[model samples]
Target: MKRRHFAEGAVVAALAQAVAVPAHAQTRPGGAGWVTSWAASVHGPYPVGNPSAQPEQRFLFPSPPDGARDQTLRLVLRPSVWGRRARLRFSNAFGTAPLVLDGVHAGLQLGSATLVAGTNRPVSFAGTGSVTIPPGGQAWSDPVELPFAAEPASPLLAGRKLAVSFHVAGTSGPMTWHAKALQTSYGTAPGAGARGAEEGEDAFPFSTASWFFLDALDMEAPAGTPVVLCLGDSITDGTASTMNGDDRWPDVLARRLNAAVPNRVAVVNAGIGGNQVVGPAEYGPGKPFPGGPSALARLERDVISLSGVTTVVWLEGTNDFSRNGNASLEAVRDGMVEGVKRIRAGVPGVRVVGATVTSALGSSSAAHGHQGQDENRKALNTFIRDGGLFDAVVDFDRATLDPGSGGLRPEMIPESTTGGPGDKLHPNRAGYLAMGSSIDPAAVLPVRR
Candidate 1:
């Protein structure tokens, strides 16, 4: 495989430029703050990474390089916590040319591609309706007040999805996207022109299971609200769980926190399917991997740069031991050590919890189910529990491991999304619930005063 290596310093510098938020935009009146209510970490440019349950996109975007031309996209995402004011982040992290976007709007979703009546609000950047983000860069929109989210702590808004619509002006070159969103989002046909302000679903004739351009959404929240970020690979990304079910372990964790702490906490997932902890030494548009960037490479952009992050749950490393990766066990362990150190340095007083990788011993996937791979996974899990590197540990392995067969529990092996036997690599909805319920909320959340 051909590999292109860019200087790590250069990549970090570029990401730093992309995440630079203006000083005035940091806080709201009376010391209210911004917390990342939702986030989808961007990997490679379009059509280069793994996307689950995706529909054919040749009709929506004929040329991947030319990207979306004069089309509107309505992305559906659920916020862990609701707020009266919110901001959106658009990224061009993997594009080869400037990404020009306009006609942006955010509203409460009534259903597929449609927003609640009188709730669609226009979003602006620096007081303007449109913004141009340079290649390898991103921009955050000015705070847009959400009239529908009057009470941030209201149970009525819990589990409701947010509809963020935006138009891609001209050609987007190579679009930055998160493949494997697992949630269906709507889009207009190419050259259909800007229809983001439309409240109806007629303008969006196509659907995709991925998110493009737009990445992070921040809600104005209380100053001390704790934000728990789950950083890992597909399991954390909800693969094989359910279609539009929001049953990922992080989603379960969020619900747990909401019931225990009310609106005092937020949980965001930053997982990418096929991702590894450190094996892919380099990643960019020229040398893209199906897994996206390595955990170490993306830690800065995905974990450190997000707003109001108080704790991190790191669940990864199974991919690094897979047949495709074949990365040594030491490399994976050290990479995680380095990653945790970076996270602590970037966010002061942040607690980092390590979750053991689950069993893939008898997986149906060709790349997994090897004895050697399972051995490596066990070694890593042992380290996670006894290494004393993390503030806490979540025993996901014990939660789903079947001692009899050395594989996932029998009840957790069947697929829940489209039905059929599962790959045994990624857990099903029941397995995810087992993993989620195993977590002790107090271990990952901030102690009450």
Candidate 2:
């Protein structure tokens, strides 16, 4: 075997001594194991969805069809929880051809595209440096130890972001991507070739506010570390919140959980901008929609298939009531009911919490602000609070609604992302903080023994 393969095999063997199971195995009964620390639900192929604050990509990816050719992309993301061993998952769920990736590395971000010294580590797949994922497929990397994260609960590591670098070996036809990353990531010009091994920013000349191919990051944590997934639309996806500030409602909730439990729990966001509980009845690469897929359609891949999820906080349905969707109130309600049943069946003993839909009574967007939309939203909120379908309920509607105006609170109207009088639909940073703080941590997490 090649020396590189031998080294990877040794790493796997060392991990087996601690895990006793394959790297893909998520939970291990009563022992510390893998838990999803960060995740982004991919919607569709490139340039087909809503992207916030996106820069022109003509230079880096001149042709969307050809997609990343011999280029390196360094994606930066924050993990809610830290651990010594980490693994990554890359998706081709929306690709039309095989996605060939190689020269992968993971390290601590040191601003822009540079990585912290002595922290970058090679990532492999089944003891190989590369992997080819067929269309509509995904692959997970072998476990690699994070030397900087030896103390998983270290305060110094809290809020730190991880930089994952990878090279697209050939033309990646129609790359599967999460459009609204809202966090800056660096990429090299097309044909740059194998720059993933570099630790400097010079090789990476361009930047993007989106994430491509890579989707989920898993970390070994104490057994039974509850992972609370916030699944919703733009609000849950941090639409109007500050960019790169990590002040989304889900981010705020993670901070709250960290303070109370101190790395004992993880919160991951699986929200897609413009996503709905129902509508767009069918979706795929051929019939791509900006919202990607419906909540019921993506539940398995976004929620059930993730690692060590113990609770799911479902907050959606606003988009379904939008003029673009015009779905009936009953249809959305039934979708949620069915979606909950599927979650229960897929992950036994998982708690599903329903968050009431916030008001879009006078949204600035052309697709929303209709009286009919607000009516349906109010009706859905009632059902979510009293429907008895969810294990628990979080009243996000009440948290942001202004009783007098029947719209978003006055203070929540100013946008925090790009700075403007905010859209009446999504809340600003202050509003997100209110929504995040409203959740009782005890409701989402089990009491410490």
Query: lDDT scores for all predictions?
Result: 0.87, 0.87
Instruction: Compute the lDDT of residue 237 as modeled in candidate 2.
Output: 91
Where is model 2 more than 4 Å wrong at Cα?
1-25, 28-30, 446-449
How much lDDT does candidate 2 score?
0.87
Model 2 collision count: 1
Clashes by residue pair, model 1: none
Candidate 1 clash figure, as a count: 0
Question: What is the per-residue lDDT of model 2 for residues 1-449, given as tens digits with 9 covering 90 to 100?
Answer: 00111132332332223312323336656677889999999978898888888888998899999999999999999998999999999999999999999999999999999999899999999999999999999999999999999999989999999999999998999989999888999999999999888888999989999999999999999776778899988889988888899999999888866765567668999999999898688999988999989999999899999998878999999999998899999999999999999998898777789999888887889999899999999899899999899988988887888889999888888999889887899889988888987876545653332
Instruction: Give TM-scores for every candidate, taking all chains together and pairing residue i with residue i.
Output: 0.93, 0.93
